[model samples]
Target: MDTRFLGIPELVEVPSVAVVVDVMRAFTVAAWAFAQGAEKIVLAESLDEALALKARHTRWMALKDGPPAPGFDAVNSPGLLRSVDLGGRTVVQKTTAGTVGALAVKDASLVLCAGFVVAEATARLLRRRAGDQVTFVVTGEDGRADEDLACAQYIARRTTESGTDAAAYLRRARESRAAAELAQGVRQGAHPDDVALCLEVDRFPFAMVATLEDPLMVLRPYAVDSLAD
Candidate 1:
């Protein structure tokens, strides 16, 4: 198995499997939504698109980072998702890094969203599922997001049967720009709780897979052991 870690600025051939990592908060929100019983999540290119999709479907909820938008149901905080009941509902989401990376990898045979919360589960799923070459897309805009790189390297090592320390990676991620911003608790929609939740390694025992369907990219949680067939 070939494991490659690529950043947003790095251009290369897409892999058979793309694991997009955004440990600051985006994928962490998706993991929390699934834990809250959300049916699925749709990735939007922008906050506007997420709102537009939610408008057409009454029950579908829209989420984004920063200040709340016109029709957004919630802010991009995993801390808030735990209290809400998302049973049988679809969540349309847009984020600065995570969703953008996910939506860009439409050509991959399999696309999985990653954060420290679901890092182990993602590795387990890939170990059992298809794909010879795996690329971990560190979705940091500048080609080097400290948080995303840590998560991607952590997950990549696990997939390659190499030993790694979750705590060590978490320590590295804490120094990231996004983590520092959230730590201040001054960002509009972001909070210290969100950063705390995002750093919980292996918090979810499932992998969030993104499947592109033309206009919409949907992410669904797949439990690792469920694919044992």
Candidate 2:
């Protein structure tokens, strides 16, 4: 099967199966929650809806993102998720880019969330769902991104050639090399902790997909530990 890459602007031409990434934060936290034993995740783009869902379901924990507008349960931070016990529970999460990308790809045949933390499983899922073309729609911070481009490059290279050299690409992307030029000219900066959190390669064994509930697309999380092997 052939592989192709697309930025956010080119999402419409994306194939049936798509991998949506917000690695610097959102999907990383989702991976962490899965590691902590969360059963399912419902992604709500708005805080009000997420809060309402959390209120209705006692087992759900809400993850809020973007700026701190006050009164949110928590902002987009992997550190905050460490304090919760998600075993047998559900999570209602919201992020600037992650949930939005999930919503955007609602029409795709299959759309799964991915991060550096869950790259291996994500890759396996992508291969299983491979089609004439594979798209990686990266959700960037504040309408632009630097980290997700590197992530797109990682997926494109791996899907095209098999296996990504994380350390090599990280160095090149970090140094702003020619092939790694996408890493430059970013107007946003993720938390230092977020950078560290999102950099882990395949630390978790789960993949999340979107399910519809009217206008909202809820994330349905599942364990894909077998894919890791």
lDDT of every model, 2 decimals: 0.84, 0.66
Number of the top-ranking candidate, with TM-score as the measure: 1
Q: Write the per-residue lDDT of candidate 2 for residues 48-96, one digit (tens) a residue.
A: 8888887887766777765454444555666656666778777788876
Of the candidates shown, which would achieve the greatest lDDT relative to the real structure? 1
In model 2, what are the clashing residue pairs, if there are any? none
Candidate 1 lowest-lDDT run of ten:
7-16
Looking at candidate 2, what is the lDDT of residue 122? 66
Estimate TM-scores for all models: 0.93, 0.79
The list of candidate 1 runs beyond 4 A from truth reads 129-131, 227-229
